[model samples]
Target chain A: MSAVGGGFGRCDAPRATARLEALTPFDRAGRRATESHASSRQLAGRTATITQDTSANPGDLFYLDLHTHSTDGSDDAGATVEGYLRWITGRRRFGYRIDGFVLTEHRRFDADRDYTALAEQYGVTVLRGIEVETDVGHVLVYGVAPGFYRDFDVTNVSLPYEDVFRAAREHGGIAVGAHAGRPRIGLAEHVDRRSVSVEGVGIVEALNGGSSDEENSHALHFAEEHGLKAVGGSDSHFVSGIARCLTAFPEPVHSVEALVEALLSHEYRPVAVEETHDDEEIRERSRRLQAVRSTAEAVHHEGGEVEYDHSVIGVEVEIGSAEITHEQIAAYCESTGDTNPLYRDEAAAEAGPFGGLVAPPGLLSALVQGRGPDPKVQYGNTTFMSGQRMEYVAPVRPGDTITGYASVKEVYEKTGRSGRMVFVVNRTRYANQRGEDVSANESSMVHRQVAPRKES
Target chain B: MSDAITQRYFEDVWPGDEYIEEHQPTGDDVAEYLHINQMGRRAQTGNLDGRFTDVAGAARQGLARPIVPGAMSMALITRLVTDWMGPLGHLRSIEVSFRRPVQHDDRLRANALVTDASDEDGEPTATLDVFFENERGERPVQGTAVVVLPRRTQPAPVVE
Candidate 1:
């Protein structure tokens, strides 16, 4: 059983010593884990504890879970907005202090009716925002009004992609690509030359609640290549899920204005829980991969450049009809920390001009596309997602078994600031259970040659 | 009724004085807690990579340093007060908030105070304030509580 104590400095003698003795082993193990994951300890290295007194000071560092959701917008059945507020306020019988939280719901819902009053009541800073799921990818628009783009039809609108980007910028909002990589949901199509030249987006999601290390690495590479600010989020729908992933800013930001300024200034780093691994063990596994035969075949070869038109590269598969549940959408949003109401609340969606519940554009991107039971791709080499360019055609309603098909369009090599990199482009088309095209996304990937000495 | 103490009764009193208790949280404790709660089980089940680093990375970023759940702190405080006041002590209220991030290797000390005690409607109740601090003397958790304790039984003086 764990021991107990008083409010502040009640017990200073035996209790203090006993506490130290009990903590020694845990402290040692934590140190070892921190040491093992040294290379990826960017956020851990910058950790500075914030106290209530220190938070009053302007320069004190604070960690903010920039992306969060609540039951008010999304279909988070387990937690209410009040529960979330109390959980973070450290005022409940069992609570914890969160510097602040941004109330980002889907554009389909009203933030004022659902979250604003609660924020005021709780005395916690709430940044009004939305996670716009566009054709290209999910973009987090912070510091915007609750209904800023309520009338905009993200899927069918003919406005240029830049117009939407500018809309966020005009609203003093930061546009961040949500989950740049993680197989189904990332924006791997936006990095194409045509898309990059046209969109000019500025932030990338480096850590997502639902992504793995490999997915995070893809996001990291995108941030590095595009010179964009990196952000992280738990994408929580359940109250307990908040703060899973956070951005530790160099200073405290207690308001929407300050949050926007922090993002604009690039003053934060992504921090998650640390992992433990031994060097030699990982090295041994890499050594084993060296024995696998290369499946390289050249369709065209020229001056130090070989183009492989591998016959098996463009395999097309159909994804059959499947039900779209609110739980699935909520889970996806929670994983990404997007709380857009169009995906969560049925009444709000019905009351909307669209007159129905609509999936967040991000969820559309996340849903698997491919026909048949065996549609998995065995990708060789690093799958570095460059960007996404999406065009939403229709609203994907619940109980719709969306059909999807994917085909590889091109593969090529280019030399950039990071030396020679290979780019592979894939196009995916989505249709409703009725066999109508609802959206299409073109995804791009870049594989860099890992120098032998620098291999992970 | 004054001499009878039940678990429910023990949870009902609130004290006014301050007190503290310290605890040590272990890695196994963390592992068990997460396993039971399934906080980040989805990521763990999806990623089959054998490296503990991968598991920890996913769990940490997904659930705040992969330590015990914050709710567990409340459960501990309830147990402490109940054990001290015996079965007749009833916990009336408990309010705790996390002050600092609690990691795997940190030792936690819970301090509490019984500030008020009185007889109401033939029952004795106490109000208390409490909090939990880490090894560095940082308050990772804080709250106020109230409990009702049983009084000693007395013979009828008039009849004697």
Candidate 2:
């Protein structure tokens, strides 16, 4: 018991379980004291009045979801309590270890059906509760006894809101506004209509899975304006929404007595469980992205061309594109470790054989980059540039806009010493803006599916 | 006799010598390299195509997010040592450990530090420690290499 004590930390805990456990509906004998029991209202309510505690003990994390619906006792319900339990703890759910839920049937409560066996079978707890539809809105009743049901006909819709809360109070039970902002039945809509004081409505379900965020916020704000405890519930009629919204107690609330104690506490907060990730990972990714973008821009400006596509073998695509200039020619020469005075010095070039600093042969790569069609093949994304057959048609000079286009000329499969491979023949033609063919490049790309290497 | 291959000999090389150079991976270069490997198919490679090509796909998978392949890191590590060795040297053995993922658009710099030198089988060998670090101070790749160099007396080993 100590291991599960003082959980969600901000909410109150059971100071004396000995006194509270006596009021628990499920007893050691697996029997409920629902028949004609005396109102332990003073003993229960007073002992459970909340204390102004801000920090809840870690062990007090009451993992129980306080609101759920079932077809077991309601004709309008879609899901069974048993099925809901399976899903709440199922594999697809990424189960957060939800302990139990209160089976709140609409306008109904069945004391004869002891869910003790079912709860044990599913390894979860199911407390008996009711969602009574009053003239104002729906209200959830916890700590409901068979005696209270016998005393009042709960099926009556016109049951005065004030009188119901008073009767619930007299019998040592709680009635919270369910889905506090859900239009007609919501507590917020009937706020000014109810003749009861704020004390009559002790709590409002501030977070309901079915309600919009705006509605939940309105309910929360309403609770703040009026001194009432704001709790949360899934208001779920089926699976999936079970623990999305929960009333996080300061301590584990495994039974009706513990729940009552925590509900009356000053600090049980409505919490929404959501996914969170590390900020460091996000920041590191951002840094890498910036670096890549800048480098790519610089690489493009440096006259290096890039292939735009490589999906289909026969499809024509742009492999590279570059505008040739004297500066670009010089930079290309410098990169290749070429020290030809004919290409570097303009005055010396005019006095030389070719005249006017004719661009070198290697300068063809930079002058006519790619802005033409490049083809892709159907091998694995791993291809080997096996061979290149290029023929120089004419000398490319400075200030020529060279565009290169490539297409699959031929493709054949062969089994060789390197294993089976698809040989893709690609033909690339470089043309200047003047429509003169600059160079013709025929290459073979080996298409092979090489498996990713295992990290050794 | 100007460059190291034509001028410098193995006897002139020394341990504790270090050199560093910057590497920048652009989207275009990565795209081109990856495209060159595409086995011309009607369909496409699954995760690698988008993950290594587009920013959106890369961002989805945290490791592939940099769109940099582990093989690329290994290649850089090899180049780091090779670029320093020149034509007068022959690489004998290389070993490396990939520390993290590299991505396209990373500011990478490779550092080669000559760690040891010795005569193995009458050959003058220099062992170098190589590592690449990105701008965020993450060492994505690190390795060591042993290369046999041509001495004033002994001939350099031939490359296979």
Best by TM-score: 1
CA shift of A377, model 2, Å: 71
- CAPRI grade of model 1: incorrect
Q: What residue runs in model 1 are displaced by over 4 Å at the alpha carbon?
A: A1-59, A90-97, A114-117, A120-123, A145-151, A154-161, A189-198, A273-456, B1-160
Candidate 1 local lDDT, A25-61, one digit each (tens): 3221121100111011111111111111222222244
Q: Which ten residues in a row have the lowest lDDT in candidate 2 chain A?
A: A293-302
| C-alpha DockQ for predicted model 1 | 0.02
lDDT by residue (B1-160, candidate 1, tens digit) is 1111122232232321223334565655454433332332332343422111233442433223434444344445543454344432334444444333466656665555443445755656664545555654344554445555654453211100
Tens-digit per-residue lDDT, B38-143, candidate 2: 3221123223635566655544432234465544444445444544664345455554444345677776656664545568577778766566656654445555
Q: What CAPRI grade goes to candidate 2?
A: incorrect
Per-candidate TM-score, chain A: 0.45, 0.47
Q: lDDT tens string, model 2, A1-456?
A: 011222111123322211223322322111121111111110110000011222333234665667787668753234567656655443112213466788887677877878888889877878877887665567888885566687676765445567667777677787888876554456665564433355688898876755544456566666777877888777654343466566666567778866776787786776543210012221122111111111000000011122334455566676655666787656544333334454567775564434455555444433343323334444444654444434456556677777777777766543221223456677778777887877766655565444342222
Q: List iRMS (one decimal) for every candidate.
A: 20.9, 30.1
Model 1, total clashes: 97
lDDT of each: 0.46, 0.53
The 10 consecutive residues of candidate 1 chain A with the worst lDDT sum are: A32-41
State residue A350's C-alpha deviation in candidate 2, in Å. Answer: 82
